[model samples]
Target: MKMTPPVTGTLELAHLLTRRGWLRTTEFNTPDCTVWDYAPSLPDQLAPEQKGAPTAIFLDNTGESEFYFVEPATRTTQWNPYSRNFDRLEDLIQWLPVIENWRAPRSHEHESPMGFARLRAQGLITTSEMMETLEHFPYVPVDPDAKVPSLSRTVAEIHQAHNDKLLSKNEFKLLTHNTFST
Candidate 1:
Protein backbone atom coordinates (compact mmCIF):
# COMPACT_ATOMS: atom_id res chain seq x y z
CA MET A 1 0.00 0.00 0.00
CA LYS A 2 1.15 3.53 -0.72
CA MET A 3 2.26 5.47 2.33
CA THR A 4 -0.16 8.14 3.51
CA PRO A 5 0.93 11.70 4.03
CA PRO A 6 1.87 12.58 7.59
CA VAL A 7 -0.56 14.84 9.49
CA THR A 8 1.17 17.67 11.31
CA GLY A 9 -2.09 18.64 12.98
CA THR A 10 -2.33 15.15 14.47
CA LEU A 11 1.21 15.34 15.82
CA GLU A 12 0.54 18.82 17.14
CA LEU A 13 -2.54 17.54 18.92
CA ALA A 14 -0.68 14.53 20.33
CA HIS A 15 1.98 16.88 21.66
CA LEU A 16 -0.69 18.95 23.29
CA LEU A 17 -2.24 15.82 24.84
CA THR A 18 1.04 14.46 26.21
CA ARG A 19 1.65 17.79 27.94
CA ARG A 20 -1.64 17.26 29.85
CA GLY A 21 -0.45 13.84 31.17
CA TRP A 22 -3.31 11.95 29.49
CA LEU A 23 -0.98 9.09 28.48
CA ARG A 24 -1.95 6.45 25.88
CA THR A 25 -4.46 3.77 26.82
CA THR A 26 -7.66 2.09 25.67
CA GLU A 27 -9.61 4.22 28.08
CA PHE A 28 -8.95 7.04 30.56
CA ASN A 29 -11.61 8.33 32.90
CA THR A 30 -11.88 10.76 35.78
CA PRO A 31 -14.68 12.60 37.59
CA ASP A 32 -14.44 15.54 35.20
CA CYS A 33 -14.31 13.65 31.89
CA THR A 34 -13.21 10.56 29.92
CA VAL A 35 -10.71 10.30 27.09
CA TRP A 36 -10.27 7.45 24.60
CA ASP A 37 -7.02 7.17 22.66
CA TYR A 38 -6.45 5.93 19.11
CA ALA A 39 -4.13 6.23 16.10
CA PRO A 40 -4.79 6.53 12.33
CA SER A 41 -2.01 4.18 11.27
CA LEU A 42 -4.53 1.39 10.72
CA PRO A 43 -7.47 0.86 8.40
CA ASP A 44 -10.96 1.90 9.40
CA GLN A 45 -13.18 -0.90 10.75
CA LEU A 46 -16.41 1.02 11.44
CA ALA A 47 -19.25 3.49 10.24
CA PRO A 48 -20.70 3.18 6.71
CA GLU A 49 -19.64 6.69 5.79
CA GLN A 50 -16.22 5.81 7.23
CA LYS A 51 -15.88 2.26 5.93
CA GLY A 52 -12.41 1.51 4.56
CA ALA A 53 -11.32 4.95 5.75
CA PRO A 54 -7.74 5.37 6.97
CA THR A 55 -7.78 8.03 9.66
CA ALA A 56 -7.11 8.63 13.36
CA ILE A 57 -9.73 9.75 15.85
CA PHE A 58 -9.21 10.62 19.52
CA LEU A 59 -12.29 11.49 21.52
CA ASP A 60 -13.41 12.61 24.93
CA ASN A 61 -16.59 11.76 26.79
CA THR A 62 -17.07 15.39 27.74
CA GLY A 63 -20.07 17.03 26.11
CA GLU A 64 -18.34 20.30 25.18
CA SER A 65 -16.28 18.81 22.36
CA GLU A 66 -17.35 15.53 20.78
CA PHE A 67 -14.08 14.35 19.15
CA TYR A 68 -11.17 15.12 16.85
CA PHE A 69 -9.99 13.48 13.64
CA VAL A 70 -7.15 13.97 11.16
CA GLU A 71 -7.70 12.73 7.65
CA PRO A 72 -4.34 12.24 5.92
CA ALA A 73 -5.89 12.38 2.47
CA THR A 74 -7.22 15.87 3.12
CA ARG A 75 -4.77 16.83 5.87
CA THR A 76 -7.68 18.32 7.77
CA THR A 77 -8.42 18.23 11.48
CA GLN A 78 -12.08 18.04 12.44
CA TRP A 79 -14.09 18.28 15.62
CA ASN A 80 -17.50 16.59 15.79
CA PRO A 81 -18.84 18.32 18.92
CA TYR A 82 -21.06 20.33 16.58
CA SER A 83 -19.46 18.93 13.45
CA ARG A 84 -16.85 21.70 13.25
CA ASN A 85 -13.72 21.38 11.10
CA PHE A 86 -10.67 23.41 11.91
CA ASP A 87 -7.50 23.68 9.87
CA ARG A 88 -5.72 25.70 12.52
CA LEU A 89 -4.59 23.94 15.71
CA GLU A 90 -4.97 27.08 17.80
CA ASP A 91 -8.71 27.24 17.21
CA LEU A 92 -9.34 23.80 18.70
CA ILE A 93 -6.80 24.15 21.52
CA GLN A 94 -8.66 26.96 23.21
CA TRP A 95 -11.73 24.72 23.64
CA LEU A 96 -10.07 21.30 24.02
CA PRO A 97 -11.25 19.37 27.05
CA VAL A 98 -9.01 19.27 30.13
CA ILE A 99 -9.84 15.55 30.69
CA GLU A 100 -11.98 14.44 33.61
CA ASN A 101 -14.71 12.01 34.66
CA TRP A 102 -17.53 12.24 32.13
CA ARG A 103 -19.67 10.25 29.74
CA ALA A 104 -18.46 9.09 26.33
CA PRO A 105 -20.28 9.82 23.09
CA ARG A 106 -23.45 7.80 22.58
CA SER A 107 -23.18 4.52 20.60
CA HIS A 108 -26.51 4.87 18.88
CA GLU A 109 -27.26 7.99 16.86
CA HIS A 110 -30.18 7.80 14.47
CA GLU A 111 -28.16 9.32 11.59
CA SER A 112 -25.27 6.83 11.71
CA PRO A 113 -24.90 3.70 9.58
CA MET A 114 -24.97 0.38 11.49
CA GLY A 115 -21.46 -1.12 10.91
CA PHE A 116 -19.35 2.02 11.35
CA ALA A 117 -21.67 3.49 13.98
CA ARG A 118 -20.92 0.59 16.32
CA LEU A 119 -17.15 0.92 15.88
CA ARG A 120 -17.40 4.67 16.34
CA ALA A 121 -19.45 4.21 19.50
CA GLN A 122 -16.84 1.73 20.78
CA GLY A 123 -13.88 4.03 19.97
CA LEU A 124 -11.27 3.20 17.31
CA ILE A 125 -9.69 -0.28 17.45
CA THR A 126 -6.01 -0.46 18.35
CA THR A 127 -5.30 -4.20 18.29
CA SER A 128 -6.51 -7.31 16.50
CA GLU A 129 -5.91 -11.09 16.32
CA MET A 130 -5.32 -13.05 13.11
CA MET A 131 -4.85 -16.78 13.69
CA GLU A 132 -4.55 -17.65 10.01
CA THR A 133 -1.53 -16.74 7.89
CA LEU A 134 -1.93 -14.87 4.63
CA GLU A 135 -1.18 -16.60 1.34
CA HIS A 136 1.73 -14.21 0.81
CA PHE A 137 3.45 -11.88 3.27
CA PRO A 138 5.17 -9.21 1.20
CA TYR A 139 7.22 -7.70 4.02
CA VAL A 140 8.74 -11.10 4.80
CA PRO A 141 11.64 -12.20 2.66
CA VAL A 142 11.17 -14.93 0.00
CA ASP A 143 12.54 -17.33 2.60
CA PRO A 144 9.48 -17.48 4.82
CA ASP A 145 11.78 -18.01 7.76
CA ALA A 146 14.26 -15.25 6.97
CA LYS A 147 14.67 -12.78 9.78
CA VAL A 148 16.57 -9.53 10.27
CA PRO A 149 16.17 -6.20 12.03
CA SER A 150 12.67 -4.86 11.33
CA LEU A 151 12.54 -4.14 7.59
CA SER A 152 10.15 -1.17 7.95
CA ARG A 153 12.28 0.35 10.70
CA THR A 154 15.45 -0.35 8.75
CA VAL A 155 13.99 1.29 5.67
CA ALA A 156 13.17 4.37 7.72
CA GLU A 157 16.72 4.51 9.05
CA ILE A 158 18.09 4.02 5.56
CA HIS A 159 16.05 6.99 4.32
CA GLN A 160 17.26 9.08 7.23
CA ALA A 161 20.84 8.19 6.53
CA HIS A 162 20.40 8.98 2.87
CA ASN A 163 18.91 12.35 3.79
CA ASP A 164 21.95 12.96 6.04
CA LYS A 165 24.27 12.35 3.02
CA LEU A 166 25.63 9.07 4.38
CA LEU A 167 24.11 7.22 1.41
CA SER A 168 23.65 8.23 -2.23
CA LYS A 169 20.41 7.92 -4.16
CA ASN A 170 21.70 4.79 -5.92
CA GLU A 171 22.84 3.35 -2.59
CA PHE A 172 19.50 4.14 -0.95
CA LYS A 173 17.55 2.64 -3.82
CA LEU A 174 19.61 -0.56 -3.80
CA LEU A 175 19.52 -0.84 -0.03
CA THR A 176 15.71 -0.76 -0.02
CA HIS A 177 15.61 -3.79 -2.33
CA ASN A 178 17.75 -5.95 -0.01
CA THR A 179 17.34 -6.89 3.63
CA PHE A 180 19.43 -4.83 6.03
CA SER A 181 22.64 -6.64 6.97
CA THR A 182 23.10 -5.13 10.42
Candidate 2:
Protein backbone atom coordinates (compact mmCIF):
# COMPACT_ATOMS: atom_id res chain seq x y z
CA MET A 1 0.00 0.00 0.00
CA LYS A 2 1.16 3.47 -0.79
CA MET A 3 0.94 6.31 1.69
CA THR A 4 -0.37 9.73 0.73
CA PRO A 5 1.83 12.79 0.99
CA PRO A 6 0.91 15.30 3.65
CA VAL A 7 -0.31 18.75 2.65
CA THR A 8 1.96 21.52 3.90
CA GLY A 9 0.69 24.85 5.17
CA THR A 10 0.07 26.72 8.41
CA LEU A 11 -1.67 24.59 11.07
CA GLU A 12 -4.04 27.52 11.36
CA LEU A 13 -5.48 26.59 7.96
CA ALA A 14 -5.86 22.93 8.90
CA HIS A 15 -7.54 23.79 12.19
CA LEU A 16 -9.87 26.15 10.36
CA LEU A 17 -10.80 23.55 7.76
CA THR A 18 -11.23 20.78 10.31
CA ARG A 19 -13.45 22.93 12.46
CA ARG A 20 -15.51 24.20 9.54
CA GLY A 21 -17.32 21.02 8.42
CA TRP A 22 -14.47 19.84 6.19
CA LEU A 23 -13.71 16.45 7.76
CA ARG A 24 -15.89 14.69 5.11
CA THR A 25 -16.54 15.32 1.45
CA THR A 26 -15.26 18.82 0.74
CA GLU A 27 -14.78 20.67 -2.53
CA PHE A 28 -11.98 23.17 -2.99
CA ASN A 29 -11.79 25.70 -5.83
CA THR A 30 -9.28 28.33 -6.74
CA PRO A 31 -10.96 31.10 -8.69
CA ASP A 32 -9.45 34.59 -8.46
CA CYS A 33 -9.04 33.43 -4.84
CA THR A 34 -8.87 30.09 -3.03
CA VAL A 35 -12.16 28.75 -1.72
CA TRP A 36 -12.84 25.69 0.46
CA ASP A 37 -16.41 24.37 0.31
CA TYR A 38 -17.31 21.67 2.83
CA ALA A 39 -20.37 19.58 3.60
CA PRO A 40 -22.58 19.96 6.67
CA SER A 41 -22.58 17.28 9.37
CA LEU A 42 -22.29 16.52 13.08
CA PRO A 43 -19.10 17.66 14.88
CA ASP A 44 -18.19 14.30 16.46
CA GLN A 45 -16.52 13.16 13.26
CA LEU A 46 -16.02 14.40 9.70
CA ALA A 47 -18.35 12.02 7.91
CA PRO A 48 -20.30 12.80 4.74
CA GLU A 49 -24.04 12.52 4.49
CA GLN A 50 -25.03 9.14 3.05
CA LYS A 51 -27.88 10.89 1.27
CA GLY A 52 -25.20 12.82 -0.75
CA ALA A 53 -26.51 16.13 0.61
CA PRO A 54 -24.05 18.98 1.23
CA THR A 55 -23.78 22.62 2.23
CA ALA A 56 -20.86 24.80 1.23
CA ILE A 57 -19.05 28.13 1.46
CA PHE A 58 -16.70 29.84 -0.96
CA LEU A 59 -14.15 31.50 1.30
CA ASP A 60 -12.28 34.22 -0.58
CA ASN A 61 -9.22 34.83 1.60
CA THR A 62 -7.27 36.77 -0.99
CA GLY A 63 -7.76 40.00 1.01
CA GLU A 64 -11.04 41.69 0.00
CA SER A 65 -14.48 41.03 1.53
CA GLU A 66 -15.68 38.53 -1.10
CA PHE A 67 -17.25 35.24 0.08
CA TYR A 68 -20.07 32.88 -1.03
CA PHE A 69 -22.22 29.99 0.16
CA VAL A 70 -24.25 27.05 -1.17
CA GLU A 71 -26.88 24.84 0.44
CA PRO A 72 -28.22 21.35 -0.31
CA ALA A 73 -31.83 22.38 -0.79
CA THR A 74 -31.32 25.22 -3.27
CA ARG A 75 -28.44 23.60 -5.21
CA THR A 76 -27.30 27.17 -5.96
CA THR A 77 -24.40 29.20 -4.60
CA GLN A 78 -24.96 32.61 -3.05
CA TRP A 79 -22.21 35.17 -3.21
CA ASN A 80 -21.94 37.80 -0.50
CA PRO A 81 -18.75 39.82 -0.75
CA TYR A 82 -19.32 42.06 2.26
CA SER A 83 -21.74 40.22 4.50
CA ARG A 84 -19.45 37.99 6.60
CA ASN A 85 -15.76 38.41 7.33
CA PHE A 86 -12.90 36.81 9.29
CA ASP A 87 -9.66 38.43 10.36
CA ARG A 88 -7.94 35.07 10.40
CA LEU A 89 -8.83 31.38 10.01
CA GLU A 90 -8.25 30.79 13.73
CA ASP A 91 -11.10 33.12 14.63
CA LEU A 92 -13.29 31.27 12.15
CA ILE A 93 -12.63 27.96 13.95
CA GLN A 94 -13.35 29.26 17.45
CA TRP A 95 -16.94 29.51 16.28
CA LEU A 96 -17.26 25.80 15.43
CA PRO A 97 -18.51 24.33 18.72
CA VAL A 98 -21.43 26.70 18.42
CA ILE A 99 -22.00 26.07 14.72
CA GLU A 100 -22.08 22.27 15.19
CA ASN A 101 -24.40 22.62 18.19
CA TRP A 102 -22.47 20.07 20.27
CA ARG A 103 -22.71 22.44 23.18
CA ALA A 104 -24.79 25.49 23.93
CA PRO A 105 -23.26 28.80 22.97
CA ARG A 106 -22.24 30.93 25.92
CA SER A 107 -20.09 34.02 25.72
CA HIS A 108 -17.89 32.73 28.54
CA GLU A 109 -17.54 29.05 27.74
CA HIS A 110 -14.08 27.70 28.50
CA GLU A 111 -13.98 24.79 26.09
CA SER A 112 -10.42 23.57 26.42
CA PRO A 113 -10.56 23.54 30.19
CA MET A 114 -13.98 21.92 30.23
CA GLY A 115 -12.91 19.35 27.67
CA PHE A 116 -9.85 18.44 29.72
CA ALA A 117 -11.96 18.03 32.84
CA ARG A 118 -14.48 15.82 31.03
CA LEU A 119 -11.77 13.66 29.53
CA ARG A 120 -10.04 13.27 32.87
CA ALA A 121 -13.31 12.29 34.54
CA GLN A 122 -13.87 9.74 31.79
CA GLY A 123 -10.35 8.31 32.49
CA LEU A 124 -9.42 8.98 28.91
CA ILE A 125 -6.74 11.57 29.64
CA THR A 126 -4.48 12.92 32.32
CA THR A 127 -3.12 16.33 33.23
CA SER A 128 0.41 15.08 32.75
CA GLU A 129 -0.37 14.00 29.19
CA MET A 130 -1.87 17.40 28.43
CA MET A 131 1.14 19.15 29.94
CA GLU A 132 3.53 16.97 27.95
CA THR A 133 1.71 17.75 24.71
CA LEU A 134 1.85 21.47 25.39
CA GLU A 135 5.50 21.30 26.42
CA HIS A 136 6.48 19.38 23.30
CA PHE A 137 4.38 21.28 20.78
CA PRO A 138 4.02 24.89 21.75
CA TYR A 139 1.94 27.49 19.94
CA VAL A 140 3.51 29.31 17.01
CA PRO A 141 4.48 32.55 18.67
CA VAL A 142 5.04 35.77 16.81
CA ASP A 143 6.68 38.64 18.70
CA PRO A 144 3.72 40.18 20.47
CA ASP A 145 5.42 43.54 21.00
CA ALA A 146 6.83 43.79 17.49
CA LYS A 147 5.10 45.96 14.90
CA VAL A 148 3.37 44.21 11.99
CA PRO A 149 5.19 44.32 8.64
CA SER A 150 3.71 46.49 5.91
CA LEU A 151 2.36 44.44 2.99
CA SER A 152 2.54 47.44 0.63
CA ARG A 153 6.27 47.88 1.25
CA THR A 154 6.92 44.22 0.38
CA VAL A 155 4.67 44.44 -2.74
CA ALA A 156 6.39 47.62 -3.92
CA GLU A 157 9.80 46.01 -3.53
CA ILE A 158 8.65 43.06 -5.68
CA HIS A 159 7.27 45.44 -8.34
CA GLN A 160 10.50 47.44 -8.47
CA ALA A 161 12.53 44.24 -8.85
CA HIS A 162 10.20 43.04 -11.63
CA ASN A 163 10.43 46.36 -13.50
CA ASP A 164 14.23 46.14 -13.21
CA LYS A 165 13.89 42.74 -15.02
CA LEU A 166 15.10 40.68 -12.08
CA LEU A 167 12.66 37.70 -12.22
CA SER A 168 9.63 36.49 -14.17
CA LYS A 169 6.22 35.47 -12.79
CA ASN A 170 6.92 31.80 -13.44
CA GLU A 171 10.18 32.13 -11.55
CA PHE A 172 8.34 33.79 -8.66
CA LYS A 173 5.73 31.03 -8.52
CA LEU A 174 8.46 28.38 -8.61
CA LEU A 175 10.32 30.12 -5.84
CA THR A 176 7.15 30.30 -3.72
CA HIS A 177 6.31 26.63 -4.32
CA ASN A 178 9.83 25.55 -3.36
CA THR A 179 9.89 27.80 -0.33
CA PHE A 180 6.71 26.16 1.04
CA SER A 181 7.59 22.62 0.08
CA THR A 182 9.66 20.39 2.33
Candidate 3:
Protein backbone atom coordinates (compact mmCIF):
# COMPACT_ATOMS: atom_id res chain seq x y z
CA MET A 1 0.00 0.00 0.00
CA LYS A 2 1.12 3.57 -0.68
CA MET A 3 0.43 6.85 1.04
CA THR A 4 1.86 10.35 1.33
CA PRO A 5 4.37 11.19 4.03
CA PRO A 6 2.28 12.66 6.82
CA VAL A 7 5.06 12.45 9.41
CA THR A 8 8.17 14.56 9.03
CA GLY A 9 10.44 13.61 11.90
CA THR A 10 11.09 10.97 14.51
CA LEU A 11 9.40 12.98 17.23
CA GLU A 12 6.23 13.25 15.18
CA LEU A 13 6.14 9.52 14.63
CA ALA A 14 6.59 8.92 18.36
CA HIS A 15 3.71 11.23 19.14
CA LEU A 16 1.51 9.51 16.60
CA LEU A 17 2.22 6.12 18.08
CA THR A 18 1.61 7.44 21.59
CA ARG A 19 -1.74 8.86 20.51
CA ARG A 20 -2.68 5.46 19.12
CA GLY A 21 -2.32 3.92 22.59
CA TRP A 22 1.06 2.34 22.04
CA LEU A 23 3.49 2.54 24.94
CA ARG A 24 7.03 3.31 23.93
CA THR A 25 9.32 0.85 25.64
CA THR A 26 12.71 1.69 24.21
CA GLU A 27 14.35 3.92 21.65
CA PHE A 28 17.63 3.15 19.94
CA ASN A 29 19.66 5.07 17.43
CA THR A 30 22.08 3.58 14.99
CA PRO A 31 24.22 5.46 12.51
CA ASP A 32 21.65 4.79 9.81
CA CYS A 33 18.29 4.69 11.59
CA THR A 34 16.36 5.40 14.74
CA VAL A 35 14.20 2.57 16.13
CA TRP A 36 11.36 3.00 18.57
CA ASP A 37 9.92 -0.14 20.15
CA TYR A 38 6.37 -0.19 21.43
CA ALA A 39 3.71 -2.42 22.91
CA PRO A 40 -0.03 -1.90 22.85
CA SER A 41 -1.15 -0.34 26.14
CA LEU A 42 -4.38 -2.28 26.04
CA PRO A 43 -3.55 -5.89 25.34
CA ASP A 44 -7.05 -6.64 24.18
CA GLN A 45 -6.53 -4.36 21.23
CA LEU A 46 -4.37 -7.11 19.72
CA ALA A 47 -5.40 -10.45 18.36
CA PRO A 48 -4.96 -13.21 20.88
CA GLU A 49 -1.93 -14.50 19.05
CA GLN A 50 -0.45 -10.99 19.01
CA LYS A 51 -1.11 -10.05 22.60
CA GLY A 52 2.08 -8.80 24.27
CA ALA A 53 3.89 -8.80 20.95
CA PRO A 54 6.14 -5.82 20.44
CA THR A 55 6.20 -3.52 17.44
CA ALA A 56 8.76 -1.06 16.15
CA ILE A 57 9.06 1.91 13.85
CA PHE A 58 12.33 2.51 12.08
CA LEU A 59 13.02 5.93 10.63
CA ASP A 60 16.03 6.24 8.42
CA ASN A 61 17.74 9.38 7.15
CA THR A 62 16.83 8.62 3.55
CA GLY A 63 13.17 9.57 3.99
CA GLU A 64 12.15 5.93 4.19
CA SER A 65 10.83 4.06 7.17
CA GLU A 66 9.57 0.61 8.16
CA PHE A 67 7.03 -0.88 10.52
CA TYR A 68 7.50 -4.28 12.06
CA PHE A 69 5.55 -6.80 14.09
CA VAL A 70 8.55 -7.82 16.11
CA GLU A 71 9.02 -11.48 16.86
CA PRO A 72 9.19 -11.49 20.62
CA ALA A 73 12.22 -13.77 20.82
CA THR A 74 14.20 -11.88 18.21
CA ARG A 75 13.42 -8.33 19.25
CA THR A 76 16.67 -7.76 21.10
CA THR A 77 18.89 -10.03 19.02
CA GLN A 78 18.15 -9.05 15.45
CA TRP A 79 17.97 -5.75 13.62
CA ASN A 80 14.40 -6.32 12.51
CA PRO A 81 15.04 -8.88 9.80
CA TYR A 82 11.30 -9.20 9.36
CA SER A 83 9.51 -5.97 8.50
CA ARG A 84 7.22 -4.26 6.03
CA ASN A 85 9.12 -1.43 4.35
CA PHE A 86 7.41 1.84 3.61
CA ASP A 87 8.70 4.81 1.71
CA ARG A 88 6.13 7.07 3.36
CA LEU A 89 5.39 7.38 7.04
CA GLU A 90 1.66 7.50 6.41
CA ASP A 91 1.72 4.06 4.88
CA LEU A 92 3.17 2.69 8.08
CA ILE A 93 0.66 4.52 10.25
CA GLN A 94 -2.13 3.16 8.12
CA TRP A 95 -0.76 -0.35 8.40
CA LEU A 96 -0.43 -0.58 12.18
CA PRO A 97 -3.90 -1.89 13.00
CA VAL A 98 -3.76 -4.47 10.27
CA ILE A 99 -0.51 -5.69 11.82
CA GLU A 100 -2.42 -7.44 14.58
CA ASN A 101 -3.35 -10.11 12.07
CA TRP A 102 0.18 -10.38 10.70
CA ARG A 103 2.19 -13.33 11.80
CA ALA A 104 5.85 -13.08 12.68
CA PRO A 105 8.10 -14.80 10.19
CA ARG A 106 8.95 -18.38 11.06
CA SER A 107 12.56 -17.91 10.02
CA HIS A 108 14.21 -16.80 13.25
CA GLU A 109 17.34 -18.92 12.94
CA HIS A 110 18.92 -15.97 11.14
CA GLU A 111 19.02 -13.94 14.35
CA SER A 112 21.99 -15.66 15.93
CA PRO A 113 25.07 -13.97 17.37
CA MET A 114 26.82 -14.47 14.08
CA GLY A 115 23.99 -12.56 12.42
CA PHE A 116 24.66 -9.59 14.67
CA ALA A 117 28.37 -9.76 13.86
CA ARG A 118 27.57 -9.78 10.16
CA LEU A 119 25.45 -6.66 10.55
CA ARG A 120 28.29 -4.96 12.42
CA ALA A 121 30.87 -6.03 9.86
CA GLN A 122 28.68 -4.63 7.10
CA GLY A 123 28.42 -1.36 9.05
CA LEU A 124 24.65 -1.69 9.30
CA ILE A 125 24.87 -1.17 13.06
CA THR A 126 27.36 -0.06 15.67
CA THR A 127 28.78 -2.23 18.43
CA SER A 128 27.64 0.13 21.15
CA GLU A 129 24.12 0.22 19.81
CA MET A 130 23.97 -3.57 19.67
CA MET A 131 25.24 -3.82 23.23
CA GLU A 132 22.68 -1.33 24.43
CA THR A 133 19.93 -3.37 22.81
CA LEU A 134 21.12 -6.54 24.41
CA GLU A 135 21.37 -4.93 27.81
CA HIS A 136 18.13 -3.03 27.84
CA PHE A 137 15.67 -5.41 26.23
CA PRO A 138 14.40 -8.21 28.40
CA TYR A 139 14.51 -11.75 27.09
CA VAL A 140 11.31 -13.08 25.62
CA PRO A 141 10.63 -16.77 25.82
CA VAL A 142 10.31 -18.60 22.56
CA ASP A 143 7.95 -21.46 21.84
CA PRO A 144 9.19 -24.56 23.65
CA ASP A 145 9.47 -26.35 20.37
CA ALA A 146 11.76 -23.79 18.82
CA LYS A 147 15.43 -24.54 18.85
CA VAL A 148 17.30 -21.40 19.89
CA PRO A 149 19.94 -20.45 22.36
CA SER A 150 18.86 -18.78 25.58
CA LEU A 151 18.88 -15.02 25.18
CA SER A 152 19.96 -14.44 28.76
CA ARG A 153 22.94 -16.70 28.19
CA THR A 154 23.86 -14.80 25.08
CA VAL A 155 23.59 -11.51 26.94
CA ALA A 156 25.75 -12.83 29.74
CA GLU A 157 28.35 -13.78 27.15
CA ILE A 158 28.28 -10.23 25.86
CA HIS A 159 28.71 -8.95 29.38
CA GLN A 160 31.68 -11.25 29.89
CA ALA A 161 33.20 -10.04 26.64
CA HIS A 162 32.88 -6.50 27.79
CA ASN A 163 34.58 -7.40 31.04
CA ASP A 164 37.36 -9.06 29.05
CA LYS A 165 38.04 -5.83 27.18
CA LEU A 166 36.54 -6.91 23.90
CA LEU A 167 34.68 -3.61 23.68
CA SER A 168 35.81 -0.03 24.11
CA LYS A 169 35.35 1.80 27.42
CA ASN A 170 32.53 3.92 26.05
CA GLU A 171 30.61 0.94 24.76
CA PHE A 172 31.02 -0.85 28.06
CA LYS A 173 29.83 2.22 29.90
CA LEU A 174 26.73 2.37 27.73
CA LEU A 175 26.02 -1.27 28.45
CA THR A 176 26.51 -0.65 32.15
CA HIS A 177 24.15 2.28 32.13
CA ASN A 178 21.44 0.39 30.29
CA THR A 179 21.83 -2.56 32.63
CA PHE A 180 21.59 -0.49 35.80
CA SER A 181 18.87 1.89 34.70
CA THR A 182 16.56 -0.99 33.85
Which lDDT values do the candidates have, in the order given?
Answer: 0.33, 0.34, 0.46
lDDT of 2: 0.34
**lDDT (Cα, tens digit) per residue for candidate 1, span 1-182:** 34334344545666776775444553344333233342332232444554221122344323433444322211122322212233344544643331111112222221111222234325542112110000001121222223332544323544565576544576555555543443
Q: What is the TM-score ranking, best to worst?
A: 3, 2, 1
Q: Give the alpha carbon lDDT tens digit for every residue of 3-110 in model 3.
A: 444435557777877787655544465545556555431222434444233555556663354433333323234455444455556656655554433323222333
Residue 144 lDDT (model 2): 20
Work out the TM-score per prediction: 0.25, 0.28, 0.35
C-alpha lDDT (0 to 100) for residue 4 of candidate 3: 43
Clashes of 2: 0
Best by TM-score: 3
User: Between the candidate structures 1 and 2, which one is better when assessed by TM-score?
Assistant: 2
Question: What TM-score does candidate 2 reach?
Answer: 0.28
Model 3 residue runs over 4 Å out of place are: 1-9, 25-27, 40-53, 62-81, 100-182
Off by over 4 Å in 2: 1-11, 19-28, 41-53, 64-83, 102-182
